[model samples]
Target: MLPNPTLDQLQVFLAVAESGSFSAASRALNRAQSVISYTIANLEAQLEVPLFERSGSRQPKLTEAGTAMLEDARRIVSDLEVMRARVKGLKEGLEAEVAVAISVMVPTDVMVDVLSEFRERFPSVSMRLNVGELGEMIDLVASGISTIGIGGAIVKQDDSLSIERIGHSFMMPVAAPHHPLARLNRPLTLADVREEVQLVVTDSSGHTKGRDFNVLSYKTWRVSDIATKHHLIRGGLGWGGLPASLIYEDLQTGRLVALELEAYEQGEYPIYAIRKISNPPGPAAAWMLEAFRASLSRCPNLEAFKAQLPFNRSKDAIAAE
Candidate 1:
């Protein structure tokens, strides 16, 4: 009766078949030629079939059964290699999976750069991104729905959370080309701003309930997310603050014009890297934070924004205040 095949026996069979000779297989496997020949002989005996056709030639030919078995043997070995690598990664405090919550307030360029690098750096770690705004973003980290949160620290932080202000996204008030605010070439007065409709991104989460930031216009159109607010502004629905990275093309193409609001000075909204205090960032998460910080620091076109700003507030000044 045929016996069950062993991994070693199968491996030896594959090596011999692939290398075309028992001596070559031994050289490739760093085993004695006799050991390779014996393993194959035992494997063939266990299977009740000859795997290699031996006509006293230096190179043995694979039988039909041996060739057919190669595919399964190769697959099993490849799967084992992957499992070994994953186990090693786990032992090194590497995260099996990571979910990063990036705030929409973070510059788009920074996100793309950091994420691109992260994929290369942590090839084995599975990644998920939760892009949110204001408190909704923070809530994800606090609730452990996201591994880390990258956005504004709008809500008062709690002991359950750890926050670090990494960098800032330059907030510019923008209006579509044909909007009333866009037509006003000079700095707009408080009355002018209050009179026009302002599109405000509201925090849907209860963390910052009823709180308003820079909502100047009494006639405000509230939206629950930044993308919606951006879409509204683009359709000439209302004017609002958008990250410079988002409007870079719009401004360049004259599709959207940065408004010169006397009542509202263009400033940097503090971007933070936050995570749960209990579940501090793991190796992959930690590297991602640094990657984000470095990328955000080099966010494109501070000079371009400076040249284009009707009035500028330095990031340091914004920090101090």
Candidate 2:
């Protein structure tokens, strides 16, 4: 096995190489010149290599081996400094890792904004993002699989978690322009909706078992993700509610049409940042929560919803997925 050089010796060697002389290295390290020279000699002896040239009457110069090791020494010292800083931050209530469960309903632009800022603000802290739909977001936090959850929960929220209303997801029933619902082109009654199919987003987590939201139709189809449901709706397969942010362009281009229902119409659902009361958010988590709230409120769809349906104060489709 190769002999190991001590950290002190490597540091001394680095100082000498950087300063170009033993006396300058001693002054920089606040050590005696003899001591600095001795440390370098011991390091070279341990590694079995000549670290400096000792020619008469000139400042000390690094040999090829010394020059090569200089980069390695700098890297080691830099890594040590980073580790020390991270540990210091951790001790000061900064989370070592921030794990968040996100809902698809949260405006995609808001999600992207919060995530990008979080990375830049907390370079030392690790991050985990789990994307889920509806109740799955809340379940991840309740089960301690995530540090916090960002979304709305339909069922009576469990008392064990702390729920903070962050913003709103403007939801409304929509269908393809050519669908039977749009063909009627007037206010729809419950009977008219029940006769058609409704596409519902189903979560495998079953966190909200035995609970159904906004299911007016007797003939319903369950799908796993919002993308598939959106695809089917665009294809005129069925009608269902979607968060306005996701289908803004669709609405503008008439790929889908918002339906006017006399009996039932979906509206704003409160988006929440949920966390277990026992596992409170650390510094990083708190920062993200604030960022999410401020950013979500400015969502173009949420603003559109506010303007388009000023008179519509309908209670949202909580698990409307």
Candidate 3:
């Protein structure tokens, strides 16, 4: 049977590669230099490949084979460390996997920032994320499909679920530059918007079925996803409200124009984190909720809209539990 190189061998190899010298690697690993050398020798013997080339007065240089294998060795060592940490977390009652369902309306940058932090904080915990529109986020959590959900407020209260308001998103009425509303040359009235095709985002979960929150136009096209709605609106196919955070750059660049409506105006939608009361979130899940809230609070677009609102009113609105 072929000899197998152990993790210790790979670790020693990586340490040497990173530190650039056996002596430096030994100091970094708090091991004897001879032991490090012996382990590398054994590893090379097992693989029948020279890992490092040694000269009488020079630092050990990695052989071609060693350079090729260096990244694989690092990945193997990293995976092992992750496995160990995951085992330890499981032993401490931290969930091995957490499913998160977030709203499509949530700023993508904020989601990326929060998930990046979550990965750093809980490297061992696996995450399954679902991005959906409106109440679908809540439905996923309520059905136990997700450990937690972050989305717009749930109008239909379910006794089995607990919800906490985490933040607020401003939904601004906007349209593409060439859209009729943008070229009206006068403040837009409801009658003007009523004649245009209003692009609206609907929920797949039917939570908002048979209801209209801010339907200004009589003619409407409903889609289930926010990205599609944004695309359609950007194409000048219609006009609709979109999260301010998502369209800040589009607005700034004049790709989309905020409508100066006569009566209907931009509205603030409360963002919430929901979890089943029956299956309360574990430590990792709880941490994710707070991380999302922190990320949303730091969003510049949301912050700008928040600044226009009464500070105390915003606080009071977000304190909804």
Candidate 4:
């Protein structure tokens, strides 16, 4: 009967396979070269196969059998790591999974960067992410569907939810170059905007069902997401406000022209990180909150907006007032 190989043996085999030499594996694993050779030999004896082609002058190379088994060994080692992490997380009282909802208005590049760091920082903590428009993000947190939410400033204050102002993004009104509003020779007035079709994003959560923000036009086209609004505006369908970060290229390339409207020239939108007051964030979620704040604070456009603002407010003060 074949003997059962131990994890230690498999680990040594993988180290030698990767390092290409038992001596190199010894340095990596902090063990004597003889110990690494002995472990590999035992692993080979138990498996009844020679894993490495032994040569006196050249580096050890994986045999056909070694190549075939390498992937399985890697998978086993990976699964063991995940198991160890989960066990450690349990010991530390960390939640097994954390759900976070992010607003679509948040720059996708920034979101990707922060979440990538988050994965490395908390490998054991599984994440559930939801991207929504307007108030849908906050609704997810308030309704217990998500542990936390990163989104625009909350309009309706509730004692059940805690809000932290992370940063601000600038929203600029824009239209396609061919759109009628863009052709006007002079600065646009409220009457000019009121005559044109305004592309607006509707709240998916129904919390702000009948509310209209910065709506000056009587004729409107409503969409549930920002991408759709951007597409429609680029097609010369209508005009509306979009995050400056999202439309920077469009503005620079003349694909979309900024509207110099009298009533709504440009506006700054506050972004927030929200969580239910009853269910405070776990360690992983708290780490994510800080990651988001740090990422946004470093955004160049947002930094410019910060410089232009009348006064700077700390996150705690913004949350408080």
Best by TM-score: 3
Assess candidate 3 and give its lDDT: 0.83
- Candidate 1, 1-321: lDDT as tens digits: 647888888788878877778888899999999998888888888888777889877689888987787898888877776677668889998999999998887877778878889888777788988888777877788778899988855667577778888888767888886777766555787788887899987777867777776778989998888788888999999899887878877776666777777567556778888888789888999999998888877764456665763443333432343
lDDT of each: 0.80, 0.82, 0.83, 0.83
TM-score of each: 0.73, 0.68, 0.88, 0.83
Candidate numbers, best TM-score first, in rank order: 3, 4, 1, 2
Q: For residues 10-116, write the lDDT of model 4, one tens digit per residue.
A: 89889999988889999999999999989988888998999999976578989999999899899998889988998998899877998999887687788999899
What is the C-alpha lDDT profile of model 2 across 1-321, one tens digit per residue?
A: 597987788778878888888999999999999999888888888989998889874788888988898999888877776687689888898998999999888888889888999988887788888988878887799889899999956577688999989888867788987788877767789999997999998877776777777889999999998889999999999999887878877876667877887465465787898999998899999999999989977765445563653232122321121
Pairs that collide, model 4? none
Tell me each candidate's RMSD, in Å, in order: 7.8, 7.8, 7.5, 8.5
Per-residue alpha-carbon lDDT of model 3 for 1-321, expressed as tens digits? 586889999999999999999999999999999999999999999989999999674799999999998999999999999999999999998999999998866787889888888899999999998887777887798788898999855877888888888877778888887777877645788889888999888777888888886888989998878899999999999999888878877876667777767566555577888988889888899998988888777655544664543212222322331
Would you list the rank order by lDDT, best first? 3, 4, 2, 1
Error of 1 at 140 (Å): 1.0
What range of 10 consecutive residues in model 2 has the weakest lDDT sum? Answer: 312-321
Better model by lDDT, 1 or 3?
A: 3
Model 1 earns a TM-score of: 0.73
Model 1 score (lDDT): 0.80
